[model samples]
Target chain A: MPEQPDQSEQPDQSEQPDQSEQPDQSEQPNAAVEPGPGHRFAPDTEWRRVSPKYLVVEVIGSIITTAIIVAALLVAFSLWGLWWTPWAAGAVALIAVVAIAFEPRRVRSIGYRLREDDLLFRRGIMFQRQVAVPYGRMQLVDITRGPVARALGLADLKFVTAAAATAVTVPGIPEAEADRLRDELVALAESRRAGL
Target chain B: MSGAAPAKPAVDLADGEWHRLHPASPLLRGGLVFIAIAGFVIANLRERVVEFFLVIFAPGQLDDGFGEWSDENDWGRDPIGGIVANNLVGWALLAVLLVVVLVIVGFWLSWRMHTFRVTPEAVEVRSGILFRSHRSARLDRIQGINITRPVFARLFGAAKLEVQVAGQSGNMQLSYLGSSLTDGLRRDILRLASGARATTQSPAPAVALPSVAAGETLAEPLPGLAQPAGPAAAPGTGPATIGSRAGAIVGQRVDEFLAPELDPELAPPESVVHIPVGRIVGSTLLGGAALWMLALAGIVIVGVVSRQLWMLFTFVPAAIGIVSYFWSRITKSLRYSIAGTPDGVRVGYGLLSTANHTLPPGRIHAVEATQWVFWRPFGWWSVRINVAGQSVTSGAEAAQRTLVLPVGTAGDVQRVIALLLPEAAEGGPVAAQIGSGLTGRAGLDGDRFSITPKRGAWLHPFSWRRIGWAASDGIALLRRGSLVRRLVLVPLARMQSVALSAGPLRRGLGLAELRLHTVTGPVVPTLPIIEREAGDALFTHLAGEAVERANDDRSQHWGREAADA
Candidate 1:
């Protein structure tokens, strides 16, 4: 675990709660692994992370996409003897390698927190998006599983609001956890149903 | 037909009686197809027609040269021409006549079958001869009512009434109703939808039942109104001679085309805000036209520098496109006016082909007041809205339909906002707040709005001082942009969700961006580069407030007695 002395450097504002006073559960060895070196905004709020096995799922997806692109280029080269096909194939392979290397860190960055009235979801490293979807505004709580994810006993939980722009997807949760979360969210949405 | 007299009693259109549309509806709807077919037929059979006329006028001059020329040219390839060349002209003419008759009969039959009925509970329409379909919109779910008079339909004095409901494919259209009756009909429908009883002696029955006898008299007035010439050329009338009557009809049509688009009965004459024609033209020139001109100048400069004179030819099409676009914008916003009525806010625009729509209370989800950089000197602002059941596609028609105020001053924007969201504009503070949002620098009015910190200037170099958000009585105001100033107002109850995002740079600066999700439209409420702690607090506050307000919101049944109370 990283050193805890960094919290002391933050300036104290009277209006803001002292995040250093709360125990940092994320640093615990048994807790879900945290990704990246970015500072958490509301450290007091407990955020649940997705399973580490999701890195394998992401790596597999990237590999399949890279293979398809390379195969297409090879087929074109065989047919027309194009000069740039080999270079394009190599560039694509290099990108796929870099993406696969960062898969573990990307998976660790995904987290969601269930607040009193809404679900706060956070994802991404370079560009972090943290959205709070009110339980009352949720029109749908859906669970979807891909073939590879299903084999690995994982699923993705999605929340849909009336506005098409509020697309929130929490991917790579264990199947049992996903189903339970879906049920809980559906019940909350029902109890606090709000019209558009 | 004495009941069809011009002085007939006011018809209660919402009495649950089935009424047929105007007689000219079929002609207006199918006229384009008929014209295309006629043009095709004429183009194909032009030579045969000329030949027939020649044979009649100059039989003695007919020579074998014509036949030899026709054979050498091999011109009888088209089916119509081939039939005539084969000496089957009479049969072909007969066939064309039959087809025309069949089409007329079909149109007449369809017109007879198409009917609509308005009851207190719902407005229903039934149409189609072969594949009959019925659609109904409940009074409580009505979003708005729009009356559109296309240029051709306007000449025939007919308009289309569309009852907008809050779902995709939920709107019901009653096309080609007599223009004179559409306003009254729309008023009656709105009254019924507002949960108000009809103003007649007998209240409509609670249960909807078709009263055919009452509808029988309703059909008489349509033809009388559709064809004004019928009464003008009444038999044995002394003052109204045939020649004079034709002149009167022409004069009346001219007056209709040139008349100002306003209904004094629906909106008070003084309340309507008219956008001056000069302002419309000026704004158009200052807008996209100026951009096009700049682009042309850039091309000319490049052409001169590169010594490629042929590059100048590219300006021809671009110039034509810009001119046409500018002209279309001017024509579309010629007589734009907006006012508040008892039912809701009424907006009307267009010169020759007018369109008027009434948006009832609480139907507007969000509103945006925007000012382009060029329009800033004139203090001109345009207002757009996010309304349910209205098409949000990007086009001239869609843009005009969604825009409540095409161009207006700060006062006009305030008045429109007051009309659209009375709750937000309450106590007159919204005016000052909006004024600040439009032009106020951040640090000067720091107390009025929660603005982006000075440290976040790197993210928005020129606009950091302008980006801010403020919340008032149940509305959130988001202001941003320096060149094109924008202020988006979203009611708390209408917020779909709230989000906070931080990029790598923002994260290092301890700042986050807040976005209030609303229905898809031109307005995207986002306030970027604010303190992270403030972002969290605002997110929590908005999420809770939205749910609380949504629970208390009774805007759906805005016209109901409970909501009014």
Candidate 2:
């Protein structure tokens, strides 16, 4: 119930357009054009969200996973006379339903912004994380697409550094945008390659 | 050796040429197992082996001599005594000699095939007879060099040299090099990796070869046959006094065993910090053994109360395991010493079999000084470091190697830190800040460290006072945890990225956790539960500083003269 107020307050804050950086729009090529739902923490910097079709991708992926689990459980029941299979399958379906319901909001929450010296990626709603990976420190930048994402023309951009803990992945990017980002990142990384 | 005269330039062993490893390399690298198996087979089947040879050479004599003995001793069931009974002892000895000769020839051939080459750009090693795999570690990417002498290898005066480069499977290992050459070879490689020109190389120190006299004597004649003797041999000892020389080598090895682990010629004559044997034992016990002992005691008490006498039977193995753990810890820390060498910081440990690792300047990614609650009473601190290629190993081996200072006092910690970060140690403020961070309690002072606010106590009730972060002179210090006080220092140049996160609880409290990402190692550089405003400022500051510092960093080519010079 306490989270309700916190969730409600986020929409109002996102609606307010960043007033200070109106004239500097020319500098930020990847800046959000419309005043879409903004990041509550970093309101001034424009954050680019994933494509809306990512929601459909998430739903389809979740449904497929649930179906596989249900099929496995039914097979177990038929073969081994497992009485608990129906209960376990029902629980899996319920969890998948809840996850699918939250798919759109989760997709909306994921955003990445390019700053002067680093790329800042932000994700999650209640437990928010913002990471700034300096362009110089980037060891590699890779783009990967799953079958579902490839059909939907979406790809994931991943940034690798010397530190394994800096696991920064920007998922659900349009395939073309992902390619552009990868090229830019690779060029920037080459220009500013900092050896560990 | 006077300062005024031009010092004799040490011979550079890394001159570009393909060099075979020590003659004993084959035996040290898994050939010993073959020898042992051969010995076991020969010892058990001495009779069968001799009889088979007798059948070929003296079949008529074998039939006449063994016919009477076979009936008397039931030789079919007990063929073990056939050599003596049939009087074929001389033939048995000949067969053993032949097997030994064949094994020696095979080993020599294998040794000839495994060759390594050192170039200005890279150290290349080509090994494996049939598979023929080649491994190369580039000079510029060299992280550190480790020289390890296992007890058996030490007897032969051989050591393993591992060239640590910056990735998984990047280590190039030279299994059995003469121990005398390992020290000089490591220094030359580090100098080359530092981008120092061969012409500008400083006069090498006169390395005393007394410790490896045994190896030198053994390796001397072999190198003469292989190639012209490289400067591996000491001056002026000939084969004329072979009897006296063998006796002298034994005396030297014994002296070497009892001597202090540090070689004065390689590192400083004295260690920067000397940890007493008593303290090492105490620290080991206080570290984890005490907890295990308590658990055991608890179990015993429960068993006694319940009258379950059988429980005592299960306790024996657990008790033995704990005791052995204690023994290993003691042995590992027996002669632990760290000192500054011209190459970098040299850390040596172990009692019988010894390991010496030289971490060159700027190789340390991050450092952490931590104090256990039990150790707090004695003011004991353990220092661990993150080196680039070191994380390839896991568990106890990784833990043991990464610990630069296993246990030391606050003063010792300061000295070790100064050695690790000479750039940060210049003006002494960093050392003073570190000293305070090691022992200081929480305070709301604007100067020194920006500590967690009083309101942040809700999140870290016990450690809120100790939780703080400070950045100065291209280094960031994060102090956290009261129970196990930890101080993490990350050179801004080495930071991979900066991350800020606030979970639901922390968000409500208006605080965030700031992490400075470095290479994966024991040190986790996180400044947890600081003010959200402070976190935001630090994130931006660190992100900018990391890039600028990285651009300005000349630590990679540390031995190379500055551009301005």
Candidate 3:
């Protein structure tokens, strides 16, 4: 199967996505025009970032879970009273701290844009992903609030479509925004779905 | 839209009455299963029962190797005969009676608990004795309706109806109904779903209770006639009415013997491609079954040489299991035929129990036609379509449902292509291009398709020349496979999303794999190890085309009208 590339042609690398610190300006205009008429983002379209309090909620939640694991390990090791138990717990606590500390930046990376006919959500730092859910295809638009999220007055807006792969979740939005977006999405979906 | 109205009661159905299953349904379903088990048990007990008979009735015959070797010296043992003639025979008879009585009770209870009702807009089934579960399927969302009759069920004039619906969940099954009413019910359901009246002033077709027994509804139209008759006065002959009912029941029996062919709307398709019986048998013998047989033979030889008779027992059941598999596949696809209808495609096949599947518009997500290395010489290929709900169900049951064509000629492949996406075959330039790339000879040198770079061939050594992709105005085609050549066609409008990725090896080879995500189905289209530059251009092009196609179809009310009609 190992066949060399034909020597007559040069291997084309022009199509490679520019991974420079700044994306190519020429590509942005083309990407923006590709979605067609009604292609323009809504005049009031704003990329709403998640609540900062969500970071506190995530960190506290992770620390609490880690504490339980540490406590369980300590209880199990009490009989032997190993000298390294405290050190190991300390190491785990440090790891948990480093992991939880990334929550704020990760939360900042998540944003959702409400367009005229669809909703766009982009998330992740290292592995970026953006999904657009057309209003007519929205089977369900739900808001879910876990205990920690509820305490922090934050909720996740989950959009479900016919193909499960197209489902997107805009996490850690303020409770008020969640209600407003959900109502608007439902109304839009109803009108569009009626035509279908 | 949120929650102004209170929750509606679940089971109301357009003023229709709940109908119990036919009287023979219980005997046909639960009782038959018990009977099969009881038959196996009785067959195993036959030798012992025969010995007991000989020892009791004829002591002379007991010397003809009838007894154990230890018992030879006492061949004339009279004490055992007394035991056999007394309590043993009575107890055995009582046990058999109890078992039969239990089976009858089980059947009766299950049948008593289950009932169904058909409304103009939906079909509702309420089953389960203790749990009391109810399921309702909306008529408009119903994707396909399958009516199957097993040989045993046919003898008693019963059939099973499965209603396939949209989405990834929810399928309703009404099993063991009298064969006489199933066709009428099937046609009525399809008509109602297509926005036609099912229960208008006509009671003769769907609700006909044997024309002779319940002649009151005789004024209604006959089913499968495509017209409702005007009410007319009947001759006032009492005996004649009874005679017709008896005749109708007998006619139903004959109809069961020849099922799919008898019902016109759901008839054996007029234009169809039938797989030859010899090809099916030959393919099975030459395919995986050959390897399985060799393995079985090795086990048998090992058992014989080791004098471990018990070892043979293990492999014997495994061998039989393999044999039954081939038997089932052959039976399920013996006379496979697929035909196109105005609304959708219809498939029918089977040896013992025949299944007829009618996939309505907008049901199929993707289509795959494949040719295995062994069957390539004979010009045989199998076609599979992915309907939304059928994939995650039981694998064995899915086999009967998703197979549009188990095996057929080149003509069948084109027919299947037309059936799967009729819109593509209507001389749409891009669609024709994609179609040719799909059904034409598998090669990288096609004019319409872009072949993978030769360097990328390292990733797919066996099938390098076959790896390529072609895009039409509304759809994209991805070709792959070496031994089992496959072409996957995904409508751009139907795609959920797309992805491009390269692993460690792919990066070194300057290649990436492109995945076009549709719903979960039998065929997942992919182009692997293509030039990275080509992958990026294709990705952007497909993404733009998908958006445009979705909007065009939606605005023109094309795809949506068919699904929501």
Among all candidates shown, the one with the greatest DockQ = 2
Ignoring the other chain, what TM-score does chain B have in each prediction? Answer: 0.86, 0.81, 0.73
Per-residue lDDT tens digits for candidate 3, residues B1-565, read 1121122222122334676777788777676776788789658757666777777688777664433434334535543334454446677668778977876776777788888887765898888877898899987678788878888878777788888887556888888776656665665566556543422325423333232122212212222121211112235556455555555555556555764533454454465576778978877766656788888889899999999989998886888898998898888877566776644577777867877787765566677777777777877777777666665546777765776877777667766777677656755654555444544534524446676677866778777767888876576878788777887878776666666666667877878777776667677778876787888787667755665566554322222244455
Whichever of 2 and 3 has more TM-score, that candidate is 2
Deviation from native of the Cα of residue A64 in model 3, angstroms: 7.2
Q: Cα lDDT for residue B527, model 2?
A: 92
Candidate 2 C-alpha lDDT tens digits along B1-565: 1331233222235766788888888889878798789789778878666766776687676655354555545666656456557767678779978987987887887788888877777999988766888888888788888888888888877789999889966788998887667776887788667665433433422232232332344434443433323223433456434534565565545544554666665678788888999999999999957899889989999989999979977998999999989988888888888998867898999998888888988888899999999999999999999988766456676677889998999999999998998855645678768976888866534336776778888988899888888888889999989999999999999899989999998998899999989988889999988899989888878887887788667678776654225
Could you give me the TM-score of model 2 versus the true structure? 0.80
Candidate 2 ranges with C-alpha deviation above 4 Å: A1-46, A70-95, B1-11, B35-103, B198-240, B251-260, B297-313, B392-395, B444-447, B562-564
Task: Give the per-residue Cα lDDT of candidate 2 at B250.
Answer: 55
* lDDT order of candidates, top first: 2, 1, 3
lDDT of 1 by residue, A60-143 (tens): 899999999999998999999999998999999999998888778888999998654578898988788888787767888889
lDDT winner among the candidates?
Answer: 2
How well is each residue in A140-181 modelled by candidate 2, as lDDT tens digits? 998889999999999999999999989999989999989988
Clashes of 3: 0
On a 0 to 1 TM-score scale, where does candidate 3 land against the true structure?
A: 0.70
Could you tell me which residue pairs clash in candidate 2? none
Give the fraction of true interface contacts kept by model 1: 0.71
How much is B354 displaced in model 2, in angstroms?
A: 1.5
DockQ of each: 0.29, 0.33, 0.09
